[model samples]
Target: MIGRLNHVAIAVPDLDAAIATYRDTLGGEVSAIEPQAEHGVNTVFVTLPNTKIELLGALGENSPIAKFLERNPEGGIHHLCYEVEDILAARDRLLAAGARVLGSGEPRLGAHGKPVLFLHPKDFLGTLVELEQA
Candidate 1:
């Protein structure tokens, strides 16, 4: 089962510009950029009162975000992350319910250093969903 909403991820073509928009323009507290090579993304988290916003930039040409940016030059909301008490259990439940899990069907270390799994976008009404362990 899903818990609380974690963070919404947005893919940006320019990471520095996005960070400035959130930090300077929006007056949000932005965290330092962290390059997640495993995930092929450079991330910056914008902290908010209720939840956080994840700014994702392509780490390399092969990055998945690069493909996303190709389709959407301006970038946009990429995924919605939700917390789960037990990620493995949640995966099993979703599998039994006919939902498709992305990648190797295993949880990976997310930006928050928590175990995270991504579900197929098609399975979630064309919206990519990420499950992060609480």
Candidate 2:
């Protein structure tokens, strides 16, 4: 049900510093910081050859990323996104297999303006997984 790896999301405490590390130091092409209020994150995508790297910062105190930062302090990989040809179909299959979907079990608009759904971390080897419509 999953396609190519979409992008790896890293939660960072400092968005600007993370962008600079990827852009100036790593010599990666970084996108402008885009605020995703709905997802409670400020995101910057670092373009890579095979896949992209999404740097995420908490949008507000209540943001989930904020809680993640509180746990890690230094920030770390928050999730892994995988592409699906049909997200709803994939969701159904996952549900049938006893996997838990985060949120309302519906796709939300992702940073790329694509439909995306998050799977429960506990269901996937303690790694959060995101499914994006291809």
Candidate 3:
């Protein structure tokens, strides 16, 4: 089952501008940008007391974020990540409940270096949901 809200991911066309908006304008503590080639994204984490905000920029032309930006030039919230005690168990439960899991239906290493799985957006009321191991 899902646990605490892990982080909300936002896709941005410009990574630096997004970082500045969160750090300089909003006065938030932003972490250094980390390139996740495997995930095809360059990420910046804005830490907060309760949760974190993940800023994602495309790493390559074929990156999913790039495609998302093509559809939404202004960029917006891409997904919501929730923590799970056991990712595999959660996947199985969701599968049994007729929820569709994205990709290979296996967990991949996420920005936090935790196993993460993405669920179909339509399955969760038109919002992409990410389940990360707690």
> Which runs of model 2 end up more than 4 angstroms from their true locations?
none
Model 1 alpha-carbon drift over 4 Å, by segment = none
Error of 2 at 105 (Å): 1.2
User: What lDDT tens digits, residue by residue, belong to model 3 across residues 29-124?
Assistant: 999999998889999999999999999999976897887898989889999999999999999999999999999998989878899999999999
- The sequence of per-residue lDDT tens digits that candidate 1 reaches over residues 1-134 is 77789999999999999999999999999999999988899999999999999999999768988878989999999999999999999999999999999999989898788999999999999999999999
Worst 10 residues of 2 by lDDT: 60-69
Model 3 misplaced regions, further than 4 Å: none
lDDT per residue for candidate 2 within 27-131, as digits (tens), equals 999999999888789999998989999999999768878878989888899999999999999999999999999999989888789999999999999999999
Candidate 3 at 81: error in angstroms? Answer: 0.3
Query: Roughly what TM-score does model 3 have, to 2 decimal places?
Result: 0.96
Q: What is the TM-score of each candidate against the true structure?
A: 0.95, 0.94, 0.96
Model 2 residue 8 CA deviation (Å) reads 0.3
Highest-TM-score candidate: 3
* TM-score (C-alpha) between model 2 and the true structure: 0.94
Q: How many steric overlaps are in each model, in order?
A: 0, 0, 0
